[model samples]
Target: MTPVTSRVEYSPIKRARVYMKHEMGIPERRIALEEGISPGSVSGIIRRYPIQKDATSCARSGRPPKLSDRDKRAILRLIKKDPYITTHNLIVAAGLDVSKRTLLRWLKHEGIVHKPAF
Candidate 1:
């Protein structure tokens, strides 16, 4: 027999319980009055809710890091070695297989002030 994994996903209302009780140091009814929510709803949330455990704050991991340390160093080195290098020329010399937008993003991340290409 395989064990079932029971994951409890509490609603925002439920999460509000702990915040109201422990953090806010007030009853649900008072909280609801201040927040403009009904006292009954707050009571329901407080009564039938599980307290949230302290979880490590993890990054959302939406997008990956644009430039690696090596890439950043390479860019800084290139700029320092020759301040006259254009964005187009740098992209070619650095051999970074990315669009001009991506390249610009990398430059921006490295705090490199890029002149508008006329």
Candidate 2:
């Protein structure tokens, strides 16, 4: 059987222990020994403590919006002025740099209904 290892590095439990050690002025080596982790791992945790303190397990992912609130408002105004404006026309009129699909998705997200080209 393999030997048991220390708690997972960067885990909440390990981070908490690292914080406690840091607060109590405990040495990295001692904390490593007590927690069955490596001194380097403990050191890394201590170094990153400040930044990680406010972090949770779940991190926000994905790219930010290409269009800002002002841009979105401009698109809304254009749509309001002419309800029959096509997505292509809207992109050109508003100087939006996003693709047609992205614009359509944004419109859908903003609850803007597109009229059929009947």
Candidate 3:
């Protein structure tokens, strides 16, 4: 069996703990040795996050999406319940606050083609 230490994804809580130890005046080298990580990693974590609040998550790039996965799933459920329903009704049934065009574009992106009523 592969060892549990083969791959390591450090959690934010652990990083916060390290920061707490650092704030207590523990040396980086000693902290690294005790935590089983490189001294450079310990130093990087200390420098990157100025405050404990920022230590929870790293900075991310790019604009955030308009709709969350839950919203998408909800819409998809509504669609699957009645696939031939028009976009306007779909928006109303889904209780989405977005415009018809925005919902249409998102549906297209998700590979759902709304069928037109005769």
Candidate 4:
């Protein structure tokens, strides 16, 4: 039979142990040894329990918006000027620098509806 290792899938149990161990001032190296993970992983688990933390224990800045507020305003102005404008024409009219699909997603997210071009 293959030998069983201390390694465990990351879950609530491991998170609890890492959090508790950290609260008790246990060193990262020792915690890693006990948890069968890298010291970095142990530290990450400890940080994940904080009130403001997300997965990686740091503020996650998602992808920066491709269009600035000015660009968005321009699109809205273009729409106000002609609500019937097709997505392709809107792109050419506004000189948008994104793909058609990306613009459609942005429009959808901003509550703008498009009549899918014929």
Summarize candidate 3's per-residue lDDT along 45-115 as a digit string, tens digits. Answer: 88866764646654545667667788799899988898788888987887888888888889888888845
TM-score of each: 0.44, 0.49, 0.52, 0.45
- lDDT at residue 61 of model 1 (Cα atoms): 42
Put down candidate 4 lDDT per residue, 19-99, tens digits, no spaces.
888889999899899878899888777766775333223344557768888888888999999998888998888888988
Q: By TM-score, highest first, what's the ranking?
A: 3, 2, 4, 1
* Residue 70 in model 3: lDDT: 83
Colliding residue pairs in candidate 4? none
Clash count, one per candidate: 0, 0, 0, 0
> What do the candidate models score in CA lDDT, each in turn?
0.63, 0.78, 0.80, 0.77
Candidate 2 structure quality by residue, lDDT tens digits, 10-108: 668767777788789987888989988788878877777677645234344667778888889899899889988989999999999999998988788
The candidates, ranked best first by lDDT, are 3, 2, 4, 1
Clashing pairs in 2: none
lDDT of 3: 0.80
Candidate 2 lDDT (Cα, 0 to 1)? 0.78
TM-score: the better of candidates 1 and 2:
2
Deviation from native of the Cα of residue 100 in model 2, angstroms: 0.5
Q: Pick the candidate with the highest lDDT.
A: 3
RMSD of each: 10.8, 9.9, 7.9, 10.5
